[model samples]
Target chain A: MQHKQTVIDIRNLSYSYVNEETSNRVSVLHDVSFSVSECEFVSIVGPSGCGKSTILKLIAKLLDNNHRNIGIDRSKMSFVFQDFALFPWLNVRENIGFGLKMKSLDKKSLDIVVNEKILEVGLSGSEHKYPHELSGGMKQRVGIARALAMSPSILLMDEPFSSLDMLTAEKLRIDLLNIWTKYKMTVVMVTHLIDEAVEMSDRVIVFGPRPTIVKKVCEISLPRPRDKRSKEYFDLCDLISKEIL
Target chain B: MSRIILGFHLTKKRKHIFTTSFVLISIAVIFSYIIIISGDNAGQLINSLMLSLFRLVSAYAISLVVATIVAIFISNSRFGDMMIPIFDLLQNIPSFALIPLFIYWFGYTNIMTIIFAATSILWPILFYVLHSLKTVRRELDDAAKIFGAVGIKRVLYFLMPVAFPSLVTGSIVGFSIGWEAIIGVEIIGLASGIGQFLNTPVGNNNNQILGISALLIIVFLINRLIWMPLLRKSQLYAA
Candidate 1:
């Protein structure tokens, strides 16, 4: 809401997978522009095949740029990949401590922060097992911990928990809200689950089909520890649902 | 507790390995006994086996070093593109066919023989490493970049572990190929290895070099019995 504190400013941001001359080109995002405030927890939801993932990839700098030029202020950016891309070689502690270790964390503080995140993500007592050893939910929890440990200026997650069962996803959604509240870390997550965006996001931005555009942005003023069963919450969910389905 | 005793998959005791090797030695001793009863030619077969083992070890070691260094060079520079097709061409040239040319150049020396053997074997290791570097998954690279792994350490951390399975795989193939190779180098070129010793009387009036041919079979047996198992277990770990 405050222009002065804006962390991201995207103007005339357009992307197409094919060259301009090609009539067959699919323009994924057209004239897409938006500003994210500092520590903003923004969720982008779209229909199944929309380019919501592509927007996250663009934010994370993983997208291949054929011609569209992307411009963003030079602040640290990190992504928690869609499928929990934990280094299979490392165990939980090493994986959580990875970004910190990369930036060269001092040994004592690294151990403390790593231990804290392990406990934070509810992944306690499993630091020695590699990613291959962990369950799917546990692996995603490891992914969340690793991203949080980086202490990045912003976080971009592409469908981070879509693969998990409903119960685990619901639990993680609560944990995600808690982490966002505590850290005030800016986050942009992609999800097809309607209630997920409504329950956790300050603002939910929906992407459109094929030639993707920001179809909608709904501001949420719901109270903390959101009640999904509440009439207002379900209303917001249903309203957002029709846009996708 | 029972699993602790023998480990995950130990069907036999440590004593079994010693006993097996002992039985093998006993079989060799019995044959030597027959040789001694028949006399002289039996002695040549024993000498030939020892010589072949030494030559194979020396050639393999040299080949491994050459391959690793060449692979490292290809991985880091523009020369990599050219080296691949060159190596492919070389892979077609049989190790034995090179012997006559090697003798003309390096001239009837062990150096010429070892070089010929090494040229035949180096391709697999070089190609394996080079291809591994080229084929690392994009997500893994992204993971590494996020971790701030850059430069040589990046390759060491991300690339090497991913490449390790291929590296070990290629080395095993190369080692197997090198075994059959030493015989060609030894017999065709000049000097002393089991192949030369076998070639000796097989070419002459005496039929005892036929006995020396037993050395080739012994080498084959040793490769399968000793080296192949070790390589297989290591490959399992690498995989």
Candidate 2:
């Protein structure tokens, strides 16, 4: 296999959360090490409370990392939260425009970029609408639009489609794949759905129960427009599910 | 193009008109009283009413600035650990109890009156902000962090908006306290204000009725114009 450039490198990464009331520390991720290649679509799959989401946060630099060996090589990174995390106070356009404003982009350029991302995410007509007015799928689209507006080299998503219905989630996953192919950005998604992990990712990193350890790393060699009904796809799904279990 | 871009789905036009009319009526009445007093027709009643309202507003503004900064500090620092307990105890003390200390220090002047009203208004606003900070959703904080929102940027874009609903409610409560406290402070201090107007209603003076009418009008206008609009905005934003 050709050596792809490493975009993310984690070695002996451990995290513990402190209880404010009891003053006790509980370890979440322990000595977990993994690397993601540049422009790769990767998914972290595990059972609940397995620190799969924590790993995404660690990569996004949203969490305090006392562990010395974690390295994210990307210059720009953005996150799409599991809950959609759209600001209820802001309209869709403003929500998408927030990171650009944070970066101090001038108004004219910010508007141009926001409008482009809004169209890319298929939320053009809903720009003036608040998050409360949006459906589950639309809200996640706005979340994706907000993350993409920053034009980040790496996009971290925490179960972006988990909150939507099966039909909506399927549609969003396909849309995301198409967008990813065009944008060619590194994606690190955390999800519990084995089928989703197998279908969307170039590689799947399966995590064990807390304190988490990297249990398995599975690669999917399935071609584009992947057929979930295929025998190979089913077998791969089974393999990933077994690894998660 | 600018109108379309800045389109805010605000309250209904009719509702805004109604609130505006209510405020305008209060202002008209207050102005009429002021005119009458200046002409020696109402005789000190309008001055007293205006004086009380002025003291309350100034003190209320001070309390707002003080409470917001203190609330932010307490929520964001180790200072919070010490300050919160102190507040917990301070809130237990009746705000009116501070009147004696102020009178001794400032000699029953406007300064004493303003400080008294500020102390009365401060606690509710501070506690409301603290509570709002405590209840802020984890997802929003993470989102803000990922976007590189820090310091004043975080406060302006994230904390203030998140705390807004509670903060507005606290301000309304604070206004109510200041309204009553300013009058009481004036009455106790025997200072020149609406409380004095209420105290001295000589027969056939008609200052009594005017004072009472002006007092009610001011309260009604403040609720209609300021608190109601803010409350509506908060609800819509929270939605």
Candidate 3:
């Protein structure tokens, strides 16, 4: 395998929240560390409240990191939120072009990029629809397209498909993989589903329960469009499930 | 099935439009009748109504701007955290109680009337916007930051839209309170306005009835023409 340049690096990253009622520091991520290479698909799998999402937030700098040893160019990053986060007031095209608009891009260029993303995400006919009008699957597609419109080098997904129905999630997982292949950007996803982690990632990093640390980093070397029914696929899922549990 | 539903919606919309037009025409007829019957006093009444309308509008505009700025400030900083309780206390003080203090400062002036009304109007808008901003979904806030919505861009593209529906609701509430404040101030101190017109001792009960009827008509029109449309549009902001 060719060595890809490292795009994200975290060493001894820890975070705590001050409990509003108690005013006591409640630790979330304790000495958690991981790294991702350029063009790699990585998933962090763990039990509920294991700080998997916190790690993603730390990378995106959405939450204050307090100068932790986290390395990633935030300007080159885009996040796909769990709840889609499509601005309710913005139509599909406007939502996708939100990042570009924030950058003060010219209208001509903005329209071009937005139009292209709309097509790329299979939302070609729904450009004028609002978020409330979109189905959960379609909304997430808009979410993904919105992130892609930024032309990001790294994509961070915080349970991007967790809110979708089973069929929608399955279809989106494949669509996401296709988009990922096309873009060739680094992806770091946090998901609780072991099968999803195994099905999509080049590597899966499992975390322990709250105040989390990296429990294991299992490399998935299975070929493209890995057979989900195959024993090997189940074994890998089983392996990750064991590590997280 | 879709076409049937669409047809039903269209029929309902037409019925609504018809009803609105009928009400508007009725009000117009009533206004014309009032003007004809109250001949000499008609001009004075119209002028007073216009003046009161202007005062209410000015106060509303000022309140909207101030409330938005204050709400954003309170929602965004630690200073805002401390100020919220103080603002809550201030809002609780009956706005009418502050009229004497306002009169002492500005003394029966238009400025005093507008300012007094603005104080009454500001609280609902400020609290509504502040609550909306404070309660924004965590993921949406993250998405905004992650996608380069910071500084003024964040406020414009993210926060403002997030606060928009609540802002409309607040404005509607604020405008109603403002009407009371403006009228109360006018009736108590000001020399001219609809409130003064209404309060003026008249030759007959007809003039007083006309004044009250005109006020009601204007309020109804404003609600239908402005606030109702805005309230409908604001629903798009809901997630």
Candidate 4:
């Protein structure tokens, strides 16, 4: 996948939040350089609060103008937050269509896309239900639907599956991989789970400590639908562990 | 003991049907006496009912509008922090203390009375709405942001519905306060209205207060009879 046309181009990006009423600065990321090729699936693993979320926030452009030191080109990016972040007031149908509505996609096409997605995600019957009426898994499904509906070229996710139980997380990882293959969209996800990155992603990048930098980028050569109990699975996890702790 | 149980059952069954055997008999006795020594009976009845409804609608409409705007501002902005101190200072000033100022400003017009009543009562409603909007889930806000809402306009579309129950509760409390204020304000300065009509019977020999009491009953009954069911239905989907 060398020189495969990178969708994201990070160049010595560093970020720090201001200390209010003072000149002090809190550094989150530093000299963080990485890129994803078209249709590549990459996962970022880091210790908690090590600027993993800050990277996604920058990509979403939900950062302050003063935080430009933590540089990002927020446009041309779509983010999936750690919390499911579903609008409780909106029904599943409206929530899924919300992004397309914002970007002003044509009404007729938007409806068609929303309908197609509702069925594709196995959420066809519960279209009219609000967020509170759904289970945690269902809420996350809606979140995924919302992000994918944007059809963004680069998708950024921040620990999207941290809330679910082991079984649900395992199943969603497979579903996510299938979705990734189908859409051929570049994805960069953050997680603390090494097994998840090994099972779902094509490449793994690790970030650590304040003033975070990319520690390693290991290519995952596993075949599709990779099972965790297999020998290769344990080896990849071990390799990631060695780099992490 | 059996008779007491029977009367309790009657009271329960006739909640709005007005069975109350003893009260109805007392009313009948008063009416018989009124007929024997009456002065313009029908005129007073009509006047009291009309005044109450007029004042109630006017004061409530004003309170609803003002309370909603204030609530939105308080909940959606950092300025909302100032609300508590402002309200506490205003509450301590006493509800009727501003009556003289109102009369001087508006010169005994209907608007004067409505304004006075609304000012005295809108705080509870505004606070309720602010509280409701503030308590909406953080996740809902993040969802709204991901959809590209950047500023004040987002509160209208994303936040208003999420705080529906609190809006209703706050509005109702405000309306009730407005209703009470209207009667008192009218009693003090206004020459026409239900409060004036009720006062006339107090000064004379008639059961005119019954009509005014009936109007009060209607306010509470109407709220439960009309809005409660709607609220319950909306809550089903909101959750």
Q: Pick the candidate with the highest DockQ.
A: 3
Candidate 4 lDDT over residue span A1-245, tens digit each: 46677667677788888878896888888888887787899999987789887777666666653444433344556667677887666789988998887777899999998988787676888999988889877878888888888777778888999998888877777787888888888898989999889988999998877779898888999888787799999998998898888
Model 1: lDDT to the true structure: 0.74
Answer with 1 or 4, whichever has the higher DockQ. 1
lDDT of 1 at B8: 38
DockQ of each candidate, alpha-carbon based: 0.38, 0.70, 0.83, 0.34
Ranking according to TM-score, highest score first: 3, 2, 4, 1
lDDT of 1 by residue, B87-186 (tens): 8887887667667787889987767766777776677877887787767666667777766766766656666666666666777687667766777677
Query: For candidate 1, what is the TM-score?
Result: 0.78
Q: Write the per-residue lDDT of candidate 1 for residues A1-245, one digit (tens) a residue.
A: 55647776666677777655865777778877777888888899988767788876776666766324455543477777767878776778988887788777799999999998989999988989887788888999998899888777788888888888888888888888788888887888888888888888889997778677788889989987888799999999988988776
**Residue A90 in candidate 4 has what lDDT?**
79
lDDT of 2 by residue, B137-223 (tens): 889888887776788888999888988997899999999999889888887778889887777647856666767777877787788
Q: On a 0 to 100 scale, what is the lDDT of residue A30 in model 4?
A: 84
Clash pairs (backbone) in predicted model 1: none
Displacement of residue A132 (Cα, Å) in model 4 is: 2.6
lDDT by residue for model 2 over A1-245, one digit each (tens)? 88789888899999998978999998999999999888899999999999998888777777887635778854588899999888889999999999888888999999999989988989878989989999999999999999999898889899999999999999999999999999899999999899998899999998999999999999888998899999999999988888777
Candidate 3 C-alpha lDDT tens digits along B65-107? 9999889888999888899999999999998889899999988
Error (Å) of candidate 2 at residue B19 is 7.4
lDDT for B104 in candidate 1 is: 88
Worst 10 residues of 4 chain A by lDDT: A65-74
Which is better, 3 or 4, measured by TM-score?
Answer: 3
